[model samples]
Target: MKATELRHLLEAALPEAAHAEQSDLQLGHMYLPAGHIKAVALSRPVVVGDRGSGKSFWLKSLVDDTRRQLIGKTFQQEELLSCEVKTGFSPDVDGDYPTPKDLARLVQDGLSPDAIWYAVMVHLIVPESLPGNLVFWKDRISWIQEQSETVTAKLRAKNAELHAKKQCILIAFDGLDRLSPSWRDTVALVRGLLQTQLEFGRYSQLRTKAFIRPDMLASPEVRQFPDASKLLSLAVKLEWEAIDLYGLLWQYLANSSIPSQSAAFRKFADKVAKLSWDEGSNGVFVLTQAVRHDENRQEQLFHQIAGENLGRGKKSGNTWTWLPKHLSDAHGYTSPRSFLVALRFAAVDSNKRKFAGKEFALHTSSLKSGVSEASKVRRHELEENFPWIGDVLKPLKGLGLPARKQDVVIKWKKAETLSSLLAHHEPVPLPEAIKETDPASILAALEQLGLCRLLSDGRIDFPDIVRVDAGMTRKGGIPVR
Candidate 1:
């Protein structure tokens, strides 16, 4: 119960939550909500989500036999294993997918994006069945370029074979944003992929899944396809409900390194929730039955770490809902990555502060400090995904939020940083409606990115996560922490 002892216990019990894109799939601890279960079960061809919402994680899980077996226990979808999954594109350069430069070259050569995807499928399926020289990717590309009809016929034949065997193929395409140099080309490629998926639907044994970002899905170019609405209708958005988030925390704690804490937490969990354990290679723990939103179980568990209130006062605010709400974006979306980042930082902060023995493992101040750190991480992600937005907002730093649009425009017009950033780097996939250097276009770009919102009151509001990182104070000069 001593502060030092608790700190060590906390350290042992809470390993840093791994980002899906960065870490190998943790099959045992994945918390799949009902919506996700439906999405995976239905095998929807298009899964759309915001960045860090576990699209890559889900795709990885689907391809993993051990993970799929574990998932099969809950969903009773053994047919998932019948499908051979392959990555058509991903952020991992070492992955089987072709590089962006290769894709760009193919586009420049006037090769249809759909043909390129089919060639990827051909590369994945029965390479030995084809000519020896065609086995290699470069040869395969050349072959597809020269004999497009032959490649299509081969894929159709393969589909027929799989169909006879009562099996199917799921070719997953992720990291589409990285597939081309410009937004225009990226959209064209994605549209082609979607079209291919639609065309392949008649085969009954060939299925494709595109894990895409929200911004890409919202782009006009992708939506302009004639049957775009049909693909959109089948889209499943990856989201985490309140119960799912709490369930994730529990799952993490149950698998903590500290045996005593893990055992104790499991015992506590057994009393109030249904628990499942994977009997495979990983032997991971999963929460099969989640607690209700109104239940105090989640609160009790977190209270052991973060305490009942953010402070000693009655009005200090409850700790359970505080973390997620504070970490949410402008659209009220919070990814699992952001939540785990905040929790890890809270642990780090608590260890540094050395709270009193009477206090919980994480202090109120430490928790708030975690929010600030998480904001920085989220900001870094934004900068990487949309570098131009970072440049556009640089001049507005130190300004307060909820300011009039005209005032924001005035400040943006006065800032020299925007021009400098634009000179050094062109906006990736310049919007169709606006030039990169246009000031009005920049504001529209910000709004589209969900970094800021144009309020009904004629003011602009930034989400706390963004507002904090941009060094923008609140309207009343309130501090984020």
Candidate 2:
């Protein structure tokens, strides 16, 4: 292919590489992560994952008919289609779940959390079945509190009817971290929902799924209930293995609308014996099979995009492992969102540089530059999710990582980082779980957020994903190359 054609192909083939936070249900293709295959198929009640690990994506997919059908087939389970899925809570404005303020008010009213959830079910499943002329959610809540037994009886009857038809009602909840004003209240609500799920287990036809962030699960308040271990035991942790990431990349590439671009990608796949087609689709191909590890094929696939080495030649570390390793957090977790963002930016860089003679779409310099772009995005995401972390870290921009705790404390004192953070965000009650008023508490919070690691040697280390974007250098004051 000519330089211009390849550039166009690079642009067209990798458009919008990152998955949207709110995934579109209409997108027919999904790369089911191997670790999550069984979890999704079994309908686990509590699913936990860090941000960008596809909790929302899976929840949205389960509610989408076409995507649900495809996913069901992937697991070879027809029962997936028998599910009547409803979103109890989501970040999407149009989602059915009540707002955080409404939930907070309900909790404050001393209404039983279990009863509140039952009321939500009544609203979704069969509003007419509810007693006492309770049409709205607020009214329904009052009625449930006033007549708990009656509401339970009605839900039981409806569950029985669905059981007879061999169907199940699956209610999903996400965005729990935003569902309440304080950590205590959020935990109380989540505990109630989990207890309700346990109680409903007897119904056989009703199931509840909650997508919770890892931090929320780790909160002591959320796990204070008597039988919290049962829910915790059943929780499915959403994870992405390296191979899973590659599978996703090919899945997107195979679905490309540009004929020549798709053709070129397929040709590249064939070279590594990694290309296969779906049964019915004429031109659609499966790049890498969804499995635990296709090391050879995955390595080849990465090389196709990022080339054989980090730069120059094989002497420069292997590109296959370098991309994800550099993008990973302190916990060694690299989200699909981050990976895709890097890929997209790399392609854009490759095209802009016009490296036509290179064997791969991404040059080493372009790939490294892509990592830098991804780092910025990841930092912004952390800030949005936990605004306090940004406030704490912004003052330490020029400080080097893998430094002693005392060094950080010195910087903290010099910059008045903690004092300013408390001052600017004062009077807005901090989440009871996160203590940001002092230096020790701020460092602890940063460690929990995976923005930095507390080394056993009494030093601190920031992951490349965070350090590069935060403008922090490594030990010895060496800047990121």
Candidate 3:
């Protein structure tokens, strides 16, 4: 087949949902990594990840019956198929839980954070028992407090009944960062939720899972409590390995969708992974276990299309490894969404080449172009969460990479980068790292964000993706000239 045809197919195969929104409910795009089984199974109370790591995606999937059952097939977890999932919190505003305003007001009303979260858990687990007449959150929390014994008894009874029926319930929490713009409120709210999850852990049939970010996990204020160490010890990070990233790529291709023609890409994908497809109920297609965990098989299969020599200028490379090597963050983690975005952009960029009868589906130049394009996406994502990042780094544009750390700091100082971010989330609380605005602190923050690399020689290195996106120059990680 021609590269053009395959490129077109690839462009259609990858999903564009880079930002994991709760509304993304496509069953076909569900590619659960083996490591995430515990997180999705609700066995782990906390799921930690950075942006684009599928935290919110899995958060929404827990409440989705179709998606949950599909997750059930991947692992032998019983609660997955015969379980009740409730949204304890999410980005979308709904009456199921307290809104940010409600949380703020509840705190101002002198209600303890633990009490507020416990009331929310009670509402999720036993909604019928919560007063139907209570319209406002404060009133409902007051009622729950007044009837604490009754509520506890009801929850215990519900758990016993679920045990009798061999079913269970999971109260899922996501978007905690959105609960309050104030960092203080966020810490209190998260600490309360953690306390609530620990209390619920006593019930085998009732479980609670909170999907959070890495920074929150590292925050001492949030995790301060009795036995906080023991409860949070079981937290899992939704990290993507190179093999897992490629596995997800193939999964998207194998289960690629076009309205009314669901299985159209199956044969094309068969030529790639050569794995059996399990046609589950409602025709949701997923690959057999052989495809997800087998790193050797994935690489061998990928090379069948990516060709033998992806490098040039008297050097050799494997596209299977090269793609991720060029795209990963400074910490060596690549987002599934970023990987797909790079491939999709590379496919589209390769269409300009018209490499008639070219053996490879992607060209080296196009692959580089794809990385550059995906970095733009990454830049936007970084800006979206940390708006200060763009302003801080703007002065370094056109500056060469592997530069001295002091040089970069001088530019940031000259630009007054710290002052610009001081007012970003002002009336509302700023996100993490805003308090530490010194040049040295800012450099550390950038390293934590995976935007810059710290060198042992006291130099700073920018990943090719970030460097290219920032219009900075780098000399390595490409074919040797």
Task: Give model 2's TM-score versus the native structure.
Answer: 0.88
Q: What is the TM-score of each candidate against the true structure?
A: 0.87, 0.88, 0.90
Best first by TM-score, ranked: 3, 2, 1
- Higher lDDT: candidate 1 or 2? 2
Instruction: Give the Cα RMSD of candidate 2.
Output: 3.3
Write one digit per residue (lDDT tens) for candidate 1, span 1-481: 3444444555554435344247554544576666687567635888988877878777777777776666666677776867777777887524566688888887887777877776777677656545775544556766766776776777788888987898987778788888887666788898888887777666677777888998888887777777878778888889887666777766666676565766666665555333433333566665434343434666676676677787677577888888888778767788877777777677767876755446666888777777777788788888777776677767778777788887787887788644655575554644444455666666666777777788888788887778777788885432654
Error of 3 at 349 (Å): 1.3
Superposed model 2: Cα runs more than 4 Å off: 1-10, 13-19, 22-29, 93-96, 108-110, 180-185, 272-274, 279-284, 288-292, 354-359, 422-438, 475-481
Compare candidates 1 and 2 on TM-score and give the better one. Answer: 2
What's the distance in Å from true for residue 363, model 2?
1.5
Number of colliding residue pairs in model 1: 1
lDDT tens readout by residue for model 2, 52-86: 78888888888877777777777776778788888
In TM-score terms, candidate 3 sits at: 0.90
Off by over 4 Å in 1: 1-21, 93-95, 126-129, 135-154, 181-184, 257-260, 268-282, 288-295, 354-357, 416-427, 430-441, 475-481
Q: What pairs collide in candidate 1?
A: 183-429
Top-lDDT structure, candidate number: 3
